[model samples]
Target: MNAPAASSHLLPAVAPRPVPQVLLDALSARFGPKQYSVAQAVREQHGRDESSFDVPPPVAVVFAESTEDVADAVRLAAAHAVPVIPFGSGSSLEGHLLAVQGGISLDVSRMNRLLRLDADDLTVTVQPGLTRKQLNEQIKDSGLFFPIDPGADASLGGMVATRASGTNAVRYGTMRENVLALEVVTASGETLRTGTRARKSSAGYDLTRLIVGSEGTLAVVTEVTLRLYPLPEAVSAAVCSFPSIEAAVRTTIQTIQMGVPIARCELIDVNTVRMVNRHSNLTLPESPMLLMEFHGSPTGVAEQAGTVQEIAADHGGKGFEWATTPEERTRLWTARHNAYFAAVQSRPGCRAVATDTCVPISRLADCLLDSVQEADASGIPYFLVGHVGDGNFHFGYLIDPNSAEERATAEALSDALVARALALEGTCTGEHGIGLHKMGFLVDEAGAGGVEMMRTLKRALDPLNILNPGKIFVL
Candidate 1:
């Protein structure tokens, strides 16, 4: 399956703005040749991300090592009215990193450094370029870890931009809840700080959160202060096989309603389980399964697991497998994290049109089952997985990009799924932001008046429309 061409109508009709030679020369002189690059390889690398959209690469890449460097680059770009797309780890699944309107990619990977760590206060401030895994490793010695893990080893800036949530979201919440403060570079190249280390405040605008999920359309994030958690004293993981996806989902709904406080509760349908088994070399039961984790005191962990096991049994869940050792737990999660890759590999030369819809926990089963039926009937190969505890799930519709019919079918399936989610009072995207794919859906979800308000805010902050132009919405 070859990658399909993205619909031109879905993208804004904005031509790539040319990068003037004088602007390039100034950037090269300001940052030195080593940090400024126009090499085809560098620009191409910074252009696309995990998204399937095939847009042209940026004309140049600026490797900014400090907040001042970012300010300078933005200042130069502002002068030229060239779009500036902030680049982090480039792991965003949406078209967040695409240089739709050509300009310079402000690469901030060089700005990764731990600026401050308040171990006692359970807070840490770091450069935006730091990856979540790197943040955990650096703070592990202090017995604290960041909980927002969006599967990919995504940079903190990227995660914040997407307001990412993962398996742990049921317990720890998303970036919207974990983030404390932000140091952002405005469209005019001025530094603005929001939020504080204190737990909460009756601040004026809550600008920290405004930038948390703005998708780089509002401003560029340079520094982030995040809330951290102390490692649990007791931890255990388990996998339970179910007769059907409904059973697994019902078990999860019951567990959450009962207030189990499960650290992680994920659902992988039988098809996805097979893919994981083949990819990870583990013979998990080739059935709908729930992979769960519990964290607390030893007694509390045991109690929670017992309650969940009982709920699973009531729903015909059996073959409960336990992974207590750290090695065993890691193996289980690594396989779960690799589910997307496994599904993609299952269909050679295929691109996945992944769907992210989240509803209230009570409505999870309805939203998932109906979508599953539609997908199965469409005859498109897909994999189903969800953080069911929080009513968020993804369906990866694998399609041959060369087949226009297949692409349309997959997209139709996605459209139906989003409509269903909305009818059930859910969102079109659970974690992924409205980059290039879901612009219309954002309108559908947020309504015309709400989207207009967002546009108002965008015009107020970035009147020049030079920051990540042609994203979130059309000007």
Candidate 2:
């Protein structure tokens, strides 16, 4: 496979230049030698993300230890007109951390601290560096859990920055719904706090939302206040195999329409099942499958499972197996979360060109069927998995990263899928924000007028355009 022709759709090719000596001296003095680095290895590590876009690394990396450190780093970068990009777990799949225009990468993974935990209010405040799994482990004794599990143990700040959601999003909602307030460091390095611990507010401009999905294009997030939920009293997992993809999708549609209240309803095509079987050492039917979980009181969970089982049987679902123990449930979901790795490892030296398109439940069957057909026809090795309960799914195209033809074929398939999703009044991206990969799709999703309004807001907030330049849009 060969790479596609260069276009404005990607970050414009920019030559890397050395960081100014004066700015380097100042940053080194402020952060100390332990925190600041101009080493090639450090720069290279900070420049890339989990996405497929190839970009040059930043000139320097700063491992910030506190909110004051972030403020100072941004302030110094602003004074020198250097681009500053925030770094978290680097698990983002949209090239959000790519240093398209060379400058510095400010790492916040060291600011891991749990500031406050209010079990009474069902809320917690913490530094941005804490990962989701760590947060849950800390609060598990209280019988409370944070539900935004993106499957990567990703940083809370990174999750907030991407406005991410995962398996539980169908029941618990995304970061936009869970995050109540934020402490941010602006373009000029001034501290700004948006919202509060209050559940809801009519306060002013709703800056928290504006910054939530900005992808570091507007400001750097330092702390996040999150909403938590009590652990469910009853939980159970089940997997059902279907005769065909449509039958599986129909089961999901009908389940949602019937109001089953399933906590997690995932769809895995036959090809994906094969990969998981190989990667996770599972022996089950090699057919289209739906992995589901029910949460509530014992009777309620039983009732929900009964309702879904009936719907699945109507669609020719069989081999219903329930994971009634904690260990069993964890093993099932861990395999599901490892689907991406399984798909990639299925083909040696292959990278995943993944697509996430969400449609209304009414149109899911059409959109997903067409996409699966297109991917199959492309003759590219691929896998399909979806959070079908919320009408969102992914198609992972496995291709040789250095082969332009393979890249082009994968991208063409992704473009066709996005077009189909848009035609059906769906979104181009469900969770991943508009980073370097999908900037072109933004204008199509949000009309020219709408995009212009976004640019205007960007300018109003960061007049210097020194904050994560060459992202979202090329202002």
Candidate 3:
């Protein structure tokens, strides 16, 4: 069964909600003139992300420098009952950071400061503006690293907001496991801290978990303390091809089930492979392939990878080649990380709808097979790539934004995939949070009661419903 779209949808404001002259004066007094931008040029720039959804620009844009700045911005917006959308890197695919309500877009990109690094504790404190790449570069020489690699160079705040996990999730786990604590500013302009930097916790309430995936719906993340891992001693990577996707997926299931402790096991369908090939200037065969990576002592990693190769052989996987050189491994991952862009560029003048689902390892084979069948039969354009180690895969569908028929067809395919995922005891969304794109499908996946509970929490934390209004649950 499918859930209906929003009832009586109200269009979002194109400009910031009309503010009184007196309030504007107050804002100018609180911060310098350059700190706030009410002009159309600024509002329009911060309003939209890479979402396929309509770009309803924010009413105003604020360059917040500190936690106090965020608090003041949220307070002022709430006073006028205006939405305060937190803007990060603007690379969100799910309409996560879009300013649909047209209020103040509080951009923290300027707060790119690395505060502290406790090598002993294996944790780092950073501002919301710090991107993962920047953070790692700052701490690389220290021999410690943050491992939640979301492919996109998304901001730590944005990643935490969306609960993002990427290629390394199968090895190091998702943002849920990496974020040790968060400093957030509530909708009421009050600041509070959630979680501690402790390695383990049996806390009364896991507020960290609540805010991590809340997608800026409850509070604005100002700072974060994240768990880190020591640099791996040894690493090995390879790109191996298979005659078919089923063979690749089956081999992945076996490798994981046999407990090879693989670090990365990503499945790239042949169509995606073709895209990557053209984009990267490689001449790989147009066959499904699995990108494998292992990290450990040299002997241990080599032995484990060989065992996985044997498992692949059993499933008829071939073309396994070692990317043993650091340069080769980096090049391989760089291509893989650019898969989404490559898929989009494969068809110019189109937007990509990246819909993904997760299934139990037991049913992963059948679930992936079903997805392949649906894509082939629907006449819709989609290519598959995923962290098969965790039974999570992303289906990229490049659709023309202008055609109603195309949009409808693509949407129908998304619904079908979501249904299939739920049927296989998986989730409608694996890593991406429920933003504007997936709200319509939430009822089918999480049920009305589950959604209501989500709304209840949103209302409890943000009674005014100003922080990212109309994001997750039906408001």
Best by lDDT: 1
- Provide TM-scores for the models: 0.97, 0.97, 0.94
Model 2, span 21-65: residue lDDT tens: 899899989988899999999889998887888888998899999
Full candidate order by lDDT, most accurate first = 1, 2, 3
lDDT of 3 by residue, 399-440 (tens): 898987776767766777777788788887888777877775
Q: Judge candidate 1 against the unseen true structure and give its global Cα lDDT, from 0 to 1.
A: 0.90
List per-prediction Cα lDDT, in the order shown. 0.90, 0.89, 0.83
In model 1, what are the clashing residue pairs, if there are any?
1-349, 2-401, 3-401, 4-401
**Residue lDDT tens for model 1, 1-475:** 2212322225677889988999999999999988999999999999988777789999999999999999999999999999999999998877889999999999999889999999999999999999999999999999999998888899999888989999999999999999999999999999999999999999698999899899999989999999999999999999999999998999999999998999999999988989988888888889999999999999999999999999999999999888888898998786689999999999999988877889999999899999999889889999998888899999889999899888888888887888788889999899987888888888878999999999999999999999998888888
Error of 2 at 2 (Å): 17
Number of backbone collisions per candidate: 4, 8, 2
Off by over 4 Å in 2: 1-9, 13-18
The C-alpha RMSD of each candidate to the native structure, in angstroms, is 2.6, 2.1, 2.5
